[model samples]
Target: MTDPSVVHAPAPAPDRIGRLGAGVRGLMQHAEEAAGLAQRPGLLQGLDPRAKVAGAFALILAAVATRSLLVLLALFVLATALAAASQISPARLARQVWIVVLGFTGMIALPALILVPGTPVLSLPFGLAITEQGLRAAAFLTGRSETTATLALALVLTTPWPQVLKALRCLGVPRAAVMILGMTHRYIFVLADLALDLFEARRSRLVGRLSPAEARRLATGIAGALFERALALSSEVHLAMIARGWRGEVHLIDDFRFRPRDGGALVLAAAILAGTVWAGSVWP
Candidate 1:
């Protein structure tokens, strides 16, 4: 009784390896998309990475220093608008970073919502009460966290990873820390590729279903194999670096120069920061 014009969806893959492969691929796709977006002609994409880095950190510090909800909300809105101007979808940007911001903030702020002494706003079943002061404190804390995260995410999304690290070094970050960050970023992709290849190879050889014990055995095997592979790869990478005459220090070609446009950007950043600080003083 199936209609010839209608098509049915394929059955879901039953193997956990297959699902894991799909998940890895999805993550890789998102990373690639974000990198691609960085290359696109946009407001922040054209700016100097060093300026962007300084400006982003400046805004984040201001957000953390202030307790005024209005200032925090304004900063969040400013970040959203900047994303839009950069041709990045605000909703998509929020999706990528909001979980980290909201989830962590909620966990830390939730205690404040009931524990702090203030006028009772709501009475709960277990003799717990939400106070107005507690609610206000929670809102302020949450807003600050979200605003800081938003600004940080926007900077990362708009700048290339290499440029970001380089900018960090230019901004006086420790060479060891920058080197570690560079290697970590590089190895993340290497590990992801290794994982996807192994998972796909297993998936291709897998039959319809694996027994529970068989699946567990395969999972253990994959984990051990990947660990071994990582160690081997790290050794090879270190050897190659040494072969290239790498010393204890890393050097990147410094191309960042503070131009007139960058100066203008810095002025704007300072103005925003001043406003935020002043708002905190006036409001508090």
Candidate 2:
């Protein structure tokens, strides 16, 4: 006896819950991909973690110390080459590192074009002008940011997190600092998974889209519940660690060995850093 002419409304989309779950899943996938990259038979992956860490540090220092745009470009090219040798896809680099850094740095550099006082390159309305000095400054800033990020990302992608932590410890980093970093990295995934589960449960229980007030209340309640659960989990983890006789030290199965290739890599990095400094000082 239902009327055939009656119109029906579409269901409301679970925008907030869906987006949160998707973001969490994306993070989890990114972490897994990074771990898989570390296991690949690539140039940086084959080197000792300590050597890789040192080399990355040297390259970063070179990037920071150089004032020449050409030098920064060279460093960026070198980083890209290293990434390729390490089996990283150019599209991945463009998507993850280059585009992100360029976008962020571009925003910061945009104002410099009109603010810097020099020979005017282009004139804008309201007596504003883009100067050669400003253009150079912006390019230098953007190039330096991009180069540094590329080098850092290359290191992170090719080295396992545990090995990187061990390398840091071996390189005279404070024990407490390393411990804190290790704990933070470990628990991030745990918290993400818990959040995803909570989101899923909430989504399943909902009959329709939440009102503004209802959504606020739900978010507040979820935040409180997550905080409580995180604290409880931390306590349980600490107690378990203590019960297992952990005395503020991390042990890994893979002991580091400095092979010939590792030594050569370190020396090459040092040489490049030295050359970059010399070139930067002498370049007009």
Candidate 3:
């Protein structure tokens, strides 16, 4: 016996600080979810970290070097297949990459569809015409961007952060650089937690909508507190590490070994990279 005329009132709009805080929280949650995916049994999970890193880098390079649309399409297909094998949802991958890649690149490429000179596909207003060349160029650019993006995300999706840093070190990256990268990643999560706490505290105390001035003042306070907190946390972390007999270097029990499978994976990646280069060269 529900009343047909019943309606719910709209929720009040969040102020700028609230919106920003929500964004921060969402990013933290999303990153944590992505990290969780690495623990799942998937295609790339058991491979040597070095092999995955090498293969992903090779694919990305091939994608960037190719100008042929067909070759680019092939790279995209390869990336998609890898994602599927790794138990990644195709729809989620597309949602994460396309929205950002296409949002900015699409805006840049849209003009080329009309401005680049070639065989006219369609005449437009102001004497501009859509050209076959422009369309092809735009498609190639977008395909390259998307394919590379997919591979990069796939790398993160497949590998844990520590292993990724280890792979980087094995790849001849400077130890200092690797350490900096690791610290940066860890600190990002720390700061995210801090932001979430600040936001939650503010939210709990908030009884009404904030005036613009109040919102601005609160945002400034939050930023200042975050900066101070970061310094304190960093010092505490360093001291704790020292207390635990930790050196400045990272140590992992899993030493990278190029097993037979790792070699096989590298060979397969090389073959695909060769095919991409050959196709792009012959076609273009």
Candidate 4:
């Protein structure tokens, strides 16, 4: 009973967790999408990637320098508010990250909230004592993680991958790991482009109507094709690498002149962080 046009036209790709919100899975998706988005022009996008790195560092520094619950809360609120203000898609972003947060993180967080060292033996369902310190500790840990994660996302969203990865290298990340990251990122697109071409070719041809068996066939066929192509690509890459004198090290070009926007990004980041923390102190 499907419409002829609906069955014929290609469906759009599903929105990934990056397109939704910022939970654990969403955070990962957000990281991926934000990397692509960082290339686009946005209010925060034009600043030097270095500035974004510095700002992210500063936010984390600010978070560590304070132990106040109000300060922590301020960080959380600022992160959430800024995310919304960015006009980024919320529901999509939330779907990407929060599910993992809810499932795995909440698993640990929920119980810790109900039990801890030296908690008052309050009457509860499972004879658990909810201590004030326990609550504070859990909130502080979770809030710090959440705030830091958001601030990191802001940096990643604003900064390009090359600058960030390079910065990571300068910050003492192991060379091999960084090199691996470099290679993997370079190849992901090569792989994805291949997949996209195949998908397009399929769509170009008049494909069958969606049936249970057909859907399974489509998925399996796509997977098998990808696997075969991947093997071919690996062999070709190996030959190419052997032909070219590609040593273990891969160099990246990163030489952008600092602009006034870089200075502004740092100042704005500092001002926001300072204000957020100060506001928390006054509120608490």
- Of the pair 2 and 3, which is ahead by lDDT? 2
Model 3 over residues 1-284: C-alpha lDDT tens digits? 87879987899887887798889988988888888999888888878999999999998989988868888888899898888899888898879996789887898899889878899999988888999999998897788888899898988988888899989988888888987888899899899989889988888898889899999999999999999999999999989988998654667887878899989999999998898888887998
**TM-score for each predicted model, relative to the true structure:** 0.91, 0.92, 0.89, 0.61
Better candidate by TM-score, 2 or 3: 2
Looking at model 1, report the run of 10 residues with the lowest lDDT sum.
246-255
- State the lDDT of candidate 2 residue by residue for 1-284, as single tens digits: 87889977887775776787899999999999999999999999999999999999999999989978888889999999999999998899999989999999999999999898999989999999999999998998898888889888999999988889889989999989988988899889989999999989999899877887888888788889989999999999889988998765667986889999999999999999999999998883
Quote the positional error of residue 84 for candidate 1 in Å: 1.1
- The lDDT per prediction is 0.85, 0.91, 0.88, 0.65
**Residue 277 alpha-carbon offset, candidate 4, angstroms:** 11
User: Which pairs of residues collide in candidate 1?
Assistant: none
User: Of the candidates shown, which would achieve the greatest TM-score relative to the real structure?
Assistant: 2
**What's the ranking of the predictions by lDDT, best on top?**
2, 3, 1, 4
Residue 192 error for model 3, in Å? 0.5
- Native-vs-model 3 lDDT? 0.88
Model 4 spans with C-alpha error above 4 angstroms: 1-36, 61-66, 81-93, 169-174, 187-232, 238-254, 260-284
Instruction: Give the 10-residue window scoring lowest on summed lDDT in candidate 4.
Output: 15-24
